[model samples]
Target: MKADPRGVLTGTHFLDGDHACCEGALAAGARFAAGYPITPSTEVVERFASRVPKVGGTFIQMEDELAASITLQGAVWGGAKAFTVTSGPGFSLMMEHIGYAAMTETPCVFVDVQRGGPSTGLPTLPAQADMMQARWGSHGDYEIIALCPNSPQECFDLTIQAFNFSEEFRVPVMFMMDEVVGHMTEKVIIPPADQIEVVPRRHTRKAVEDYLPYGTNGDGVPEMAHAGEGYKFHVTGLTHDEHGYPNMTPATQDKLVRRLQNKIHDAIDRITLLEEECFDSEDVVVVSYGITSRVAQRAIEMARERGLKVGKLRLITCWPFPEKRIRELAATTKAFVVPELNLGQMVREVERAANGKARTFAVPHAGGSVHRPEDILKVIVEASR
Candidate 1:
């Protein structure tokens, strides 16, 4: 596939988390970014604000996170791939509007560079504490696509994937990162723009008179036409019908909600991505994500040298949890160790998927740093014995 001249190509080079994320959004063909400057995640907006104009895109720093998020929604409605970046507090402030994005079937990317949480915990420190919140931060029942990156390269790559998924599914995709990945400097070789595959938002070719904003075909995803592109359509948070008009009727609400929810939920097999190493023969599995995956991998290698039957399942996409794979591994593995920087946010989902068959344990670290390999190895050894 020819890379979009606008996309980032593959290679290795060192870059800070924020820069790589900005580059990823650009490579994904994002033409607009609106965000507020918050610690840890501030650099993401700073970099994007400076670079977006160079690519003929718009980047605005709103007065606050709430405004920033809603601005991104407007940008997406205007026919541009849009995004925003924030930390825990800012993310909290954006939750109501995030719910609005979800309810409206808006396609946009939200990059949350997590720091210590619950008010202003730690501005510069890293934390994976936002895992559960990312899944249910909003008020209603909705599905989210979130990707966590362990390295600067993965940060860039996954940011692009987040945009693609959000556009394809018409949902808000969160690019979940920590201050560690956000601030760390590493070499990241950006591929030539021509090598990146940028997925554009699906548009209907029908005439303006024939367009239906929320009308669905076989796939539950409604064909969307950009505003001002000759398609007069209404978009609101209120329950509506296929034509996008306001409909307070319960039947219309049920049908609209079910279709919106099913469009992504039913495509679980297609949306979830996981990486399993030494999965077949291993009796013990170490499940990890983000920067913690690196520690888990090292622990697995050390355990292997000590004659321990340990493997790993590294989650690339955190949301729409890989329940099927977790179940399969749980059926065979003796125990599963989940090591994370938080006090066990994602482990709950792992346990649920394990269905009591696999004994799940969590090795958690609070704010500021990642779990060391030795700590994870200790858990592995204990589980093996």
Candidate 2:
């Protein structure tokens, strides 16, 4: 709980969500950030811009989200860990480049501090409406790691995890944050520098002339060598072979795409992170993520006190949805309830994972409001009976 010499807290301190996220990215070893100012997410960039420079990092505010995303990609290729922060509208603008980053297997974090709806619907309000979009926002069949955090402290912790996942899988990771959590001020415990496990991108110790940019070993992750490191390499959106050069042949393209997808899917059991509280004895399970999970947790406790068998699964990684865990719960639990600030986006995933073994229901709320624990408890009580 003591403050580090740097004045960052090792335990809990009252801090805004934006500052927590910035600190998390820094702690995760991010060396560059490029972003354009957008509501509900601007503070994240602002905080990073101020802090990054102090740590010998680079922060640039680009003209728009497209440029911001592209700039981060360039920074990553320049041998620095990089990221960008934006909201709904800006995320839409960044889609094309996001697809590019995915196709090229770039390791970077994109923080989406979610606001409401299509085209800036509720700029300052909380909404998990982008849950589905985070999975398929960019075109094509590439894999991505997306994490959602329910509290300010988690906003710090999971941002680090997001970067680690991105680097490990060689994919773009999304940090999904709702306005409620992004703007709220709460107690956050920043761990000591040594206590935090920082995962840097894998680089080769092989001789410069022997390096192949996309050459994979047994686990399918290639050692990445940046440009200007005296390592000749090619990077592009087009399907490329192990050397990173474009391969237009259908067979080669197929191999490239499949590897990109499978590397992530095969690691799903390992990459999927979730927290289950009181999962074993429950007849009904409340599935939620981000801030909604907090509500669901309270609801489960109240339902249990009322002699109802209820538990909660807090999704830490939203993308590559926790199918294995959900399947296990489906076989044992009687019903599953999902609550989100948006309507039915994540509940669909829950139902798919449940596979008809348990009834899946959604409690959706939007327009600056959050689902209350009493409302979630009511559903749990009904399911328990």
RMSD in Å for all candidates: 1.6, 2.4
- The whole-model lDDT of each prediction reads 0.86, 0.86
Clash statistics: count for each candidate: 14, 1
Model 1 per-residue lDDT tens digits across residues 1-385: 3345643535676789888998898888887988898999888778778877777899887899999999999999998989999999999999998888888899999999999877899999988999888889998678889899988888888898899999889999989999989898888778877767677888888888988888877799888888878887788998888888899898998888888789988998988888878556577898898888887898899999998999889999898899899898888888889999888889899999999998898898886777788999999988776
How far out, in Å, is residue 151 in model 2? 1.0
Candidate 2, residues 1-385, lDDT tens digits: the string is 1212242336668877877998888888887999998989988888888777777788998988999999999999989989999999999999998899888989999999998888879998888888888889888888888999888988898888898898888899999998989999999988777677767778877898888888888677788888888997789898788888988999988887888889899999888888987546578989999888887888888887888878788899988888888898999999999989887888998999999999998887874767888998888877776
Candidate 1 TM-score, true structure as reference: 0.96
Largest lDDT belongs to which candidate?
1
RMSD of 2: 2.4
